[model samples]
Target: MFKGSFVALVTPMLASGEIDKDSLQNLVEWHIESGSHGLVAVGTTGESATLPMDEHIEVVKLIVDYAQGRIPVIAGNGANATDEAIFLSQEMAKFAIDGFLSVVPYYNKPQQRGMIAHFEAIASATDLPLLLYNVPSRTVADLKTESVAQLAKHANIVGLKDATGDLNRLAETKAVVDNNFALFSGDDGSGCDYLCQGGHGVISVTANIVPQTMSEMCDAALANDFALAKKLDEKLVGLHKELFVEPNPVMPKWALYKMGKIKDPCLRLPMVLPELNSQKLIEQRLSQLGLIHP
Candidate 1:
């Protein structure tokens, strides 16, 4: 059901730190037109952690409704607390969401047994298809392949978003996981390699800014057109280096706001505005790509 390029959407906000609804809807439509296969709301790219519950669920509902089945809406239902994840999971499931992108429990590192229990409880609670998100850089506790393959036994646990960046682990997961189970790259930089190693797609942050190019790269990788994929990857070469010069969405939001595609691009506390240097880098690249006005 969920396959191909899914953009990890940026949550557009006003200067006063409120989400801009019209801008958000427009962004969703833009992704659909640019050939993104689906959309992920309120993930790391959206700064999901900083959003209040009402705003979070509201964003999920808005994206689900906006997508209107043209593409799947995968809600980011991740929390360090299993209870918090459960609450958000149930809330999002109330909408017409096609799937839940559950990050490996962040902050409070859980053991393998705890990880299994957490996902099992979520599966028991809702019918939304589950996409296990393993971005160890943010979540700290990596969801290992042994455990992920074991969890894939559940009918609802459908796929994985691997950010581990270790090609060997991806190979292991592909080797052990069920033939029907799917794998998608979570790291934008090495996404082509992951696809070559049997990854079906990517949950991409880069796609938010350059969906056409990202979609082409994923299509090439899926079709085993390594030559074309490499060609497309060159267009995105700086994206991997610059987007993280500060942190995600900070740079991405700047890119979009510079393009006047978004309004204020306010980021929440603890994760403040980007450094002037980082923002300048973003501006320079956006200009170079012709994505921003001078």
Candidate 2:
């Protein structure tokens, strides 16, 4: 059910780090109007690591309510603790959220067997389809190919978001997994190639600014129109790289604030605004892409 440009949405917050409820709702509306395929709320780009559980659920609930089934809402239901992950998924499933993007258990660095067990337990916890988020750069514990194939067997374990940026593995992954299992790219830099190589879509950070473009690009790639897809993807190459120049959401949130899309670019402790140099580069790139006026 999850395909196309699902934006890893930025959680709008005030200068005091309070969740900007009105701004958050407005952001959701903007994405839907801009033709984003779906929304992935409170993911790493949304600063999930620092947000308290209560606030995390509140953010998901806000997106779910605001979406009102207009678009799919994939709640970021990942945790290092398997039990916590299961509990959060079960609770969030109570809402109208369409699915869950459960990242690999981070820091703990579980073995492949342990990874299988962790995800299986989560899949059994709720009927909601689970998309395994494997961003090893942040998680440290990579979900190896074998483990992913094993997890794909579970009826509720629907798909995977591979952020490794290794397209070679896609062929091998497709070979073992069921045909129905979706494989999405979590890396925006290689998203077009990933789609060309048979990825269903991307859970994108860049889409926070260029939702319509990203959606169009994914649609073109999925439709086998590589010429148009490449054309669209070329324009987004700068955003895919610079958005991560200062850690996620740091630059993404700032870009939004600069575009006047949000009230404040304020981020939680341990993540501040980008440096002036980084800001200038981002602003120049945005202007070149016509995301904002010069």
Candidate 3:
């Protein structure tokens, strides 16, 4: 049931590097008002790597609490350790979250069989629907089409967020799985194309800065109006490229701060602010899109 622009929400942080509850709640309200289809809390764009387990769980809970069932909140339950993933899913299942976005096991690089088993175990641990996430660029472990087809058999495993950005995988994976199984593009750049080619939606990073455009684009594509979708997507093409000028939330958070959506653009250690040049580029894109003043 998860479709449209599901923003990989960036967790707003205070100057002290603590979660900004007010900004988090404000973001949730803003997304709902802005017509974003869903929110993926604590995902990679949310800086899941830097957040400790307690903080991770807390963010998901806070998002769920703030959303109040207006929009779906997909918790990022990905962990390299199978048991840790399962535990995170089990814990998040206690909240009102709609599903779990479990990424392919990273760092360790599990085999296809291991990946299947890893996902199956997490799916079995909770009743919430599970969406497989395959962003091999970061995870280093690709979930093969065959493996994804195998995991799609589980009743709780409903969909996948394929970040490989390879559109060919769309037809290839669709050929193997049932039509009802949702395939969401995790890459924002090709998101509209993916939808035009039969993807259900996008788990978008760009949506963090431009929710309305992303939502409208996905809605148009889903409605089979490709011309409108492409038009809307063109407005986001620059944002899609520039937001990744630095690693994920660094640029997104800074964009939000510039737009007055959040207080501090502070990231945890290891993910500092974007370089001055990168900031200038991001600002240029934001200005071009009229998201910020020149």
Candidate 4:
């Protein structure tokens, strides 16, 4: 179903910034063991923006290989240009990825017609089922529920990743979209509410650190166990907020490094470390939760 606790997996790097395959594979195996439903590789968490084309594809290919049937790999293939997105999605499709997570075009800020054409072009060029990603916070172009409804009618466009953190439109999209198309929340903090409000699940950066927590939360919500879901949600609230204290993946990488799950906690250019004050709090919570050695 491609729903529920898809980790926006970070591309773990060595101190010198080489792709840390050993750590990446270990993380994949860990997610499967931890009950993650799927894995999203080369995403914002994976630092896709900084990765070179070849390296990006290589990361996707490697994750597909290492996962070795353990889980589905939803490769992030977003770009400002439809043609570029097409080429990238096609390249990524050569691997064992189960689907593509393409974002709404950014920077150039295309209009609604352009948005329709962009996704339609990619869907035309490749057969990969797509989960449309709309994070206007980063992309700057919001896809209205109307455009999403239009796109969902396409044969290959399968679902949406709603990062706007607005439930009103999510309810609208879920109400109007074709029968089989689905919706997923990209925001982690209220992801439980989203799922219960008819979203299929989440593409969660929070899952990178709390894989089991996310998976369990989604399962609880799906089973209509709000009481249990609330308890797990409480366990993850500080984690969900702190991970985004600055830029995403910065604090997430930091938390994982302290857990000995990763090597150096470095992000690529244009992304910097969080403030020193916040790092202590981040580590403090991790210690309080016993995620790190005290």
- Which candidate number would show the highest lDDT if scored against the true structure? 3
**Candidate 2 per-residue C-alpha lDDT over 1-294 given as tens digits, one digit per residue, 9 for 90 to 100:** 578999999999998779999999999999999999999999998889999999999999999999989999999989999989988888899999988999999999999999999999988999999999999999899898988889998999999999999998788899999877888998999999999988889999999999999999999999999989999999889889999899888999989999999999999989988999999999999998887997
- TM-score, every prediction: 0.97, 0.98, 0.99, 0.98
Please, what is the whole-model Cα lDDT of each candidate in the order they appear?
Answer: 0.87, 0.92, 0.94, 0.88
Weakest 10 consecutive residues, lDDT, candidate 1?
Answer: 264-273
lDDT pick, better of 1 and 2: 2
Q: Clashes in model 2: which pairs?
A: none
Predicted structure 3, TM vs. truth: 0.99
lDDT of 2 at 157: 90
lDDT of 3 by residue, 73-114 (tens): 999999999999998988889999999999999999899999
Ranking by lDDT: 3, 2, 4, 1
Candidate 4, residue 251: how far the Cα is off, in Å: 1.0
Q: Give the Å error, residue 268, model 3.
A: 1.0
Residue-level lDDT tens digits of model 4 in 153-172: 89999999999988887879
Model 4 bad stretches (over 4 Å): none
Question: How accurate locally is residue 172 in candidate 1, as Cα lDDT from 0 to 100?
Answer: 93
lDDT, model 4, position 264: 76
Backbone clashes counted, model 1:
0
Per-residue lDDT of 232 in model 3:
93
Question: What residue pairs clash in candidate 1, if any at all?
Answer: none
Give me the runs in candidate 3 sitting further than 4 Å from their true place: none
